[model samples]
Target: MKPIPVTQKLSVAAQLQPDDFQELSRLGFKTVINNRPDGEEASQPGTDAEAAAAKAAGLDYVFIPVTSSSMTDSDVRRFAEAIVASDGPVLAHCRSGARSFYMWVLAGDVDVQGFSDDKLVAVASNIGIAPDASRAWLATHRRTGKPDVKGFYDSRTGSIQYVVSDPTTKRCAIIDPVLDYDEKSATTKTEHADEILGYVTDEGLTVEWILDTHPHADHFSAARYLKEKTGAPTAIGAHVVDVQALWKDIYNWPDFPADGSQWDRLFNEGDTFKVGTIDARVMFSPGHTLASITYVIGEAAFVHDTLFVPDSGTARADFPGGSARVLWKSIQDILALPDQTRIFTGHDYQPGGRKALWESTVAVQKHSNPHIAGQTEESFVALREARDATLPMPKLILHALQVNINGGRLPEPESNGRRYLKIPLDALEGAAW
Candidate 1:
């Protein structure tokens, strides 16, 4: 079996045959780690046979079975402990070795080396492993990418939507497209979303996915409208359930389903997918909202609500389920991306009355962002909370959330044959305005 070396002392390999224990010992490996759960594959060898062969070959073996689909932080901690207990060089095996590599990456996620998924995939590919087994990992921790990113700014809510296109196949994904609503007259229009649809039509791009970073507070989501217009599926972060639960109590909607049944797909952390040839992944970036996620497509990070650009500082973590301390860590993760990685934020307030801008680089943010540059986590949290306390809640927070939390669909028509939004008095007690 060809072994992929992750480090001088640790290596990963595909399912090792029972007869391969001697070879592992001969290669100077002192311990073997089995990361695959039992019965994962019908043709795979049993752990007992592998353990028996390892014992006969004088190599220590540990069965730390892990399900690739449902890996947890505790699993990573256990794998790290197992590695520490091993003697000399350690060997880990899974169906294709990607899961082992992912574990190592997770164990080192907080380590100083900052091993990202881009680095992991590159190293795995060099060792003859196809590495599709860790698509979820790569998507969330992608280091470098260059998808064609175009932003559409909605003047009403100071929100920015995006149409990310794959250069090769002309397939695209719409991100955070807004459904314009006039709170004054309760008028709903598609002007904001139609602009993006027009761009897709003009470019001859096929709409494959209509994505939302989270149910926006400042604006209604055009996800349902766009899905109907383009015949594409809609998706959002899975933790949006937490947002729905919190809002349901405020609105007193006993019948609201907080199970994330609204969207066609509910993405968990590290989930990966594709838009044409461009690989996209999800990273759960809560704090600004309980379900905020960053879409890492190639080298571009669609960091919604975590950052507002260098001039405007970061997003306010004062909404329901928001945390300033958590937002600080989320911003740190975004800053960890490659220096040159293009960052596309969710909104731009056009501070100083300048033209709206939505693009920046990680390098730019780390060095120049007023909220980030020279600020430690504690300092950033203090600053963010102080600023959040003085800011008014988004004008559309109440009206938008009901529609946004329900996957961008307005509430069903009432007996009068028209939909209406329910506004709870004093529901947001801490709203600055």
Candidate 2:
């Protein structure tokens, strides 16, 4: 087979490939990291063929297979070491590039400060990867020195939702919260949001902003509910307009607002705001979807769904409008941050059936993530694209996108005064491609 061509370059460090080793060499990549395990018969080319091609192209190659449910911390650490020992731009690949991209994101030297879920997704997609799972994982892993902050996280939804309080002013702002939704009841609940509200009331913390990294696909956002209850402004990435536009068509909602006026604040790239003691900056990350963003606060970044616990790897970018090329770039930008910066993601599904583990140091990720370390942009892209080709669309894509694009609010009530979710028959056929 001929070498693959590079279709997207992730940040200044990564790239997406359609199996073009010559292009990788031409672009000055010296090493390749393969994240795909052998024998994923449906979507990937055989590992032996990839290794032969890499050697034939005069590049050093290493294969470190990482599965979604089986990766360990040691695996992540080893991968990071490989990147440190390598020379020149490295390319990492796996099915869909998410595994490789996440490994690199876990590798320290990346800054996720001010990146939102939608922004993370955008940046990830720019290089052809997905940030959804990674973004959620980031949130679940937040770290704080304040006892109140720590206590709050420990008590709430096994997730972190913080309101930074200034010593002088005691006022605070909330970032990325969980508003519990009862799927069986088809009704939204306020158990999680109420907890935060109680904290605000008891601690004398003034509510400022109800922030979200993106419209979460896996969980309902409590932004609207919180905003309704607290009168605080709810905000998200400005690119949510794009998400709204995309999902509006999918849901066939004629009444949905395409202009993005629904959100109190629609942040754009490089936007900044004051949230108590923290100055939140916006970074567009977007591989999981077109509207992901990251929020940078002080030395910590609420990265939402761009990365995971580092040990378990990164997010998935298989949803519609998601691309492996974009995810690679987003991860590169995150990996370029200060080494000690804490990267907090949105969710986690712990391996070993242990309690869900969240949080990973930037240093820890830089050295260990199995996917992206020691991989070049070109090679990583090729691997990601090939891998993504075999993935199936996310299970909750339709339901999630519609609600998420609306800033986590459900569709409007119909004539019967009940909201109904639409399922387009045959619309998703051959979606694995």
lDDT of each: 0.83, 0.64
What TM-score, to 2 decimals, does candidate 1 have? 0.67
Q: Roughly what TM-score does model 2 have, to 2 decimal places?
A: 0.61
Report per-prediction Cα RMSD to one decimal.
15.3, 17.3
Off by over 4 Å in 2: 1-168, 382-394, 415-417, 431-433
Residue 158 C-alpha lDDT in model 2:
42
Candidate 2, residues 1-433, lDDT tens digits: the string is 2212221222122223436666778777777778778777655666677777788888777777887665555666556656555666667777666666566544432322333345545656655554666556444432222111321343323455666554335566677766665555666667777888897887787877888887766666677778888888988888888877877777777888887787788999889887565566888898877888887765566677677776666677766667667887887887776665567777666666655544555655566666566767677677766766786765555555666667667667999999976766566657773
Winning model by lDDT: 1
lDDT, model 2: 0.64
Predicted candidate 1, C-alpha RMSD:
15.3
